[model samples]
Target: MVSFGMKDLLTLPITIVTGVYTALKFIYHCFLRPLQSGNSQKTRLDQASLFYEGQAGIYDATRGGLLRGRHTMLALSASHLRILRETAANKRLVWVDIGGGTGHNIEFMDDHFPVSSFDAIYIVDICEPLLQVARDRIAKRGWKNVTVLCQDATVFWLPEWLDGIDPRGSVSFVTMSYSITMIPRFHAVLDRVEHVLAHETGLFGVADFYTAEKQESLIDRSIGGLDKGCGWFRRWFWRIFFEFDHIFLGSARRSYLEHRFGTIKSLNGRNHFLVPYLVQIPYYIWLGRSRFRDNYPLDRSLELEYVSQESPGIPVEDVPLTPFHYSITKHWRVPYFLEPTHEKFHSFTRVFTPEDSMELIRHLEVSRDDSVLFVTSAGDSALHLAINSRPKQIHCVDPNPIQGHLLELKLAAIQSLEYEDFFALFGEGKHPTFRSLLDSRIAPYLSAAAYQFWKRDKNNFSSSFYLDGSAGQALAFMRSIFGVAGLSKDVIAFCNSDTLVEQQPIWQRKIRPVMCPTIAFLLRFGWRVFGIPPNQWKMLLKDGDVSAYVRDTLDPLISKYLLKTESHFFHLALTGHYTPQCCPEYLTRAGFERLRTNKGEATDAIRLHTKSMLSALRSLPASSLTHIVLMDHFDSSETRGS
Candidate 1:
């Protein structure tokens, strides 16, 4: 129907043109479009709900090799299963592998603990092909206890989700090893977990793609894998695909837990580090200047217009505790290096406590009590302890007014509202009274940091980050607590692993073989010795070298005093471990005073409080304090002394 000359040949038929364009478009999309694999996960990648459904063929053909330490993950999870089920005095538990195909995870655990009698095992996943792979892999070894489910993990109310499972502690421990990175909006999944997990009793075993920091460290390791034809494209492709997961997506775990649970046990369970990208470090920021003329601008989330609504019109109410979904690998890498505080960790005896208040009120001690001032170096708890004790005058000063406000509000919710009701709004069980109390007297002087953490992202399902702006101080404090997990133990471990995200590269390739095996062995042995899970081991060790870099690098004074028991950091507000938020702050002397530092202000007079150290009682004033509670827990006398 179409004979063409040279000119006519240039002009193709509409059908032919359309077909060629369609084919090229497909090829481009498959290779380049982020929807195929992009850094910005929040954006819709394609018209289809299944993000990578069509690309499944290529994904399988070149899905990156088993992630580094995948074997260890299998081994660690299996070991845990063995210790739990087979071992006689263990905490009987159930295993739930979310996104677990047929049984790569459960199979190993089952093989090891075969006679152990598992309570139950649930393998949940979405893709049928993976499920098929899981099924085929699992069939190699039979597991009567395992049950596979091909279903959407986001479905909160799947009757079969945990129907067949039960545990000794009445828990179904869920593990998401390297799978959560695939989830785009993982918050809903978290909400489901919170609702499903039995209250006060359940271990959530989580591991995922490494953080941005780890990934950066691994780029070189990957290079070794690459230059040697070790599959660079696979590593780089998946690594790039996970860029958002390492930073933005994973960041939600911190915010989610704080918003839902109040305290951060682990942003992926390793208690040592504080994630920075989300932590608000002093990095180069690239944000556009706001175009709005008004001081307060509204956010556009599903619609064209919506105000912060923290506005007066709505009559502000506290948000109820809503469980968020953000599962992190137990491996943490934030606050750099952190240690759990030693004994008496949570035992900071507030001068305002009921028992202590009476002591101040008694006898000749009250003779000059006319100027009885209450200074809190504590967080929100100060108000309750102060008001309940009927302090003659309470001058609660906090460098961060937000903490003061929270304390104040906590005091109010305690006074006017109910704690349970307050908990509903904030999801935290501690004193709900702090919010209303803050609304009244304390709201005026909210700290700059607190305002940003609490109010800036109101609709966001996350925790407030007081550690970002004050990270330098927080880092200084963290090193003081957790004794660098015996890093020699860590480094030796690094040398033994098969595939670690190596940091340095040798100039000579011949030198490579020696380094690889040495590093691999070090890694393997470290986990074996320390009794740390593979997930946790990765969190602490960087480039297979776990020597506490951040902690050891602190100013010499901080490094020495904080770790050694001689320091007063022991009797402070550490959540059972050393953390960034626990350290003392020079910024909020008033707030720190109210929370009441272990010793009074670093005033010139009390500077001699230290018994052994050269440093004097530094930071505040003795005049700032009106009373002190002396508990004789020290060595010399029966009671403990500071």
Candidate 2:
């Protein structure tokens, strides 16, 4: 019901004209622009200049949403550089940004690491227009350490090298943000990168659009963890879509980069910022170091010295090198074959160790010189060893891959989580923000398998991580039995008892008579839930009746130690969770602080192996272990034969 006047009619026409003009301008400058063809044999630089001449001014505004992972790439590089700076405090730190258009990446880096901290910063690109914009940015920021270079990335050199002095192995960091795919002859550029990067401390970071095949080689899968393959449609669609702008998204670029460097961390993601977030573009961020530097030969005398310190009688030279000895991160975990038919163990078998860890620590007297290896059952023993004794090294071996995943989650929680969050996760077995913490903070330190496992099963923490495993199910069964028999109050009272004297009366009057009989009968059918095989059950039967064995074990633990403050094993069994006063040592505030201090020195010393104990021992260097806590596994004849 509205009528337009002459001014309103004119305003509508003007607005329409402005919208059309802006759209045409953006399309012409970004997509429809013609290349400068003065000569048929134009160099790569000439083409790059022509492409950016009209788009440089509007580049940042137009492409801001399209270019993803720029910030993540820079932040990851900064983290590695900060770590490297600790070791090379006396040396000058340099950074080179290849194809760094308009100095946007350098400016964004200020949010993560200050730009002035670098001794020198260079922005190398083939486009003069972009370099000019970068120069303006540097001047506006008043940064004397920054430089804008209009040169090809392959032939670029530091200013010091121009004086006829070779500056090989001097640069500390090199980054390529969304530029590797645009470069012609990227192999030569990658080769030149190795020549200029420091042999030992250099780090290379890159993020760009890529297309991978549906299947990759075994070697690629092993070396490049989490670098997954793309679907056929996506791989084909993005490659053809980007080729119109002369940007190549082939898989060869990423493969060659991995071949040239040892991968420290690699992540695959999708860019979903285009076309109202419906179109997804595949991309990757890679952090790497020199492969040659990582695989350098070990000193024979030092190797023998380390081995003989732990085990004096074995010869070092006789132990051949295994694949476990050579890893990019120097961790003991290696790629192993996963059986297709095997059903994975998705929960903890033992909620707590049957063999007392405190008693083991007291008797074994684990010292700084000792290197201990033990089963990673529920990760209690290894964590106990790591906290109670700061041993030189601790190896956690388990054939069940999910068990290894659980241990990794525990270690990562110790490293990245605070005391309160740690308590909520392991003590109460429920955390609300576990998914967010796992994605942002914990993903970087975990392996691909571990990360994927936790990502899928993160909801386990939403209810109760302890209540989802087989051991948890068994505990639930026991609690249900207590509820039906109206003995839950007595059990709670027994766990709350301050001294053994208070516990003995409660156990003798109400708990033992009911629990002992029920346990003896349930032990036969429920042994598998507790991870007890038939052979182990048979061995238990050889000594005495199940009722007597149950009575003997429970009576001593209850009669000797205070249940509320002294014993976490029976406490967790009685209740579904542990109290702050009665829990594993690693769950204590002092223990968590000790493990979290000094960049997690205690947790860092532990290595996880997803293999049999015998296989792990065979792969280890001769005499590298000082103590071996086989636990009750040696009680099984099958294990003893192995």
Candidate 3:
């Protein structure tokens, strides 16, 4: 009615556009623009607080899967604490969870570590909104032990934060969960943590995003696995991607931490953002003690008892006491067990053998009456022979005392536990209550050295204890390699394949390409951690192409034996454990009974020696041995011993 002109209609369209733009601007100002406004001029704490102001409500929901390794880090820390708590009577546990937004990590960790067990839990963060969320979560649980403080992590004084509960710099555990990447002064924060934990036997743990520089030296790169750093592309792409949201993914954060502490354990894992276009993010969880020897010092007396044998001068108890008992006894004056020492013989750290026991048995053609003297790589081959072939007597010996301990545990488990429990302990490769089981049942049958070794490593059972030794590490490395090549599914399928025919196609199609020259180079270098000594590697490459040797050696093992479901070694490598139907012969019920009881229904056939094979053999009478499975003994030997 006012005007019937084209100009008026065009003006209406302009007005509509103006209204939409205003609405969008208002929304951005209210929510998103503030997140991007915290510039370099502002204090880091203020910036963090401003960023998290509106985020705390949705923090847990947003970060549930984006943040990884919370459970694993907590579990490892708690296991470490279990050992400390048992030793310390008067010491009260103190925990300081840095940047514990919304109290989600603590709540998640509650399964592994009881929140109330700590005398105090100080949730420290600069954001009051986040702290309030933590405060509310703690309050709802009616937990009196937890206290939330909105303080700068870089300079927060522990004594003041604790309200004078304890003097300054006294805390047992200081953990940073997914917060180190957000700190502007992370180096200063780490310095503060190192200071706060100065007085106590503390563990400083952190899980955060990081990018590691690529190595120019292939040799160095090969040895530097996930525990060290990432590749060139991952380091660059992730650094830029995370830096956009005010998060830093520099290598300095992790390098500085390692320089400040004695590394106990560190693991790198990838967390996928689950969004369309976002790539997988690499994060690492590290646990360490202070650089000083105050925390968990190497107990000289305990080491002596575990590594030493009963010599003539030392008063040997009729039944060897646990290492804990020896620690309390303080027998520093006891003479160290005398064994002729050689560097080459003592270099191996693996308590278990990587060789396939079934293959060894098949190739050796061992008889029922064979008297076997094996090098005792884990004593698994000996046990297999004993159970399958019913060997007359088996002598398992090693220079490293730890290997003897593993054999002793296996024997004790066979003797005391049911088939199911034994399978769980050794076959499935883990048993949560291994310590309790060892104390109540297995320890009585073990020697002083063997008892102490297993006692020290009792916590290994908390996870896959089978994965603790070098053989496990090799399998783990293989699994990691497969995962990188996106062949994990193919590996699972191959491992689960019932017949050779079923697995051949899968291997050729999906797995063969992963064995490229690059993988071969990396694996050859990584063999060091997998228990292949430098000299042994040289011996393997003496006559043939290294890549061909590796491929020929592994192809049949993986495709034929593993796919046929006859090789538990590869099965365990592919999957963390073995099914009852697919485990080792010694792990089966019939095999367990046969080993536990001989044709005469007795259980004293297997023997373990903690001394060198030469010492053990010299002590035995001549013409006493039949089958000697040296496990490449001459390959590593410098000279013949009497």
Candidate with the larger lDDT of 1 and 3: 3
Predicted candidate 3 versus true structure: per-residue lDDT over 1-642, tens digit per residue: 575688878799897887676555544534465554545635555666666676566667556677887766776577556655655646768889998878887887687678878888888887888888888898898888888877778877555444655544577888899888888788898888877673435777678887777544322222222234566888788888777677898877776776565555556666776663456688876666665443232334533354254343444322222222222111111112323352234323664456778778888877767677888776778777876676677777777655655666777677667888888887777788777666445543443334444654436667766666655666666667888988888778877887787877887787766654544675567766666656687877777777787678777766546443577665675677777777777778887888776422323456666566677787667988888877677656666544
lDDT of each: 0.34, 0.76, 0.65
Highest lDDT model number? 2
Model 3: lDDT equals 0.65
TM-score winner between candidates 1 and 3:
3
Sort every candidate by lDDT, greatest first: 2, 3, 1
User: Could you tell me how far off, in angstroms, the CA of residue 102 lies in candidate 3 after the best superposition?
Assistant: 1.0
Cα distance off (Å), candidate 3, residue 26: 17
**What is the TM-score of candidate 3?**
0.51
What would the TM-scores of all predictions be? 0.31, 0.72, 0.51
TM-score of model 2 vs. true structure: 0.72
Better of 2 and 3 by lDDT: 2
Question: In model 2, which residue pairs have backbone atoms overlapping below 3 Å?
Answer: none
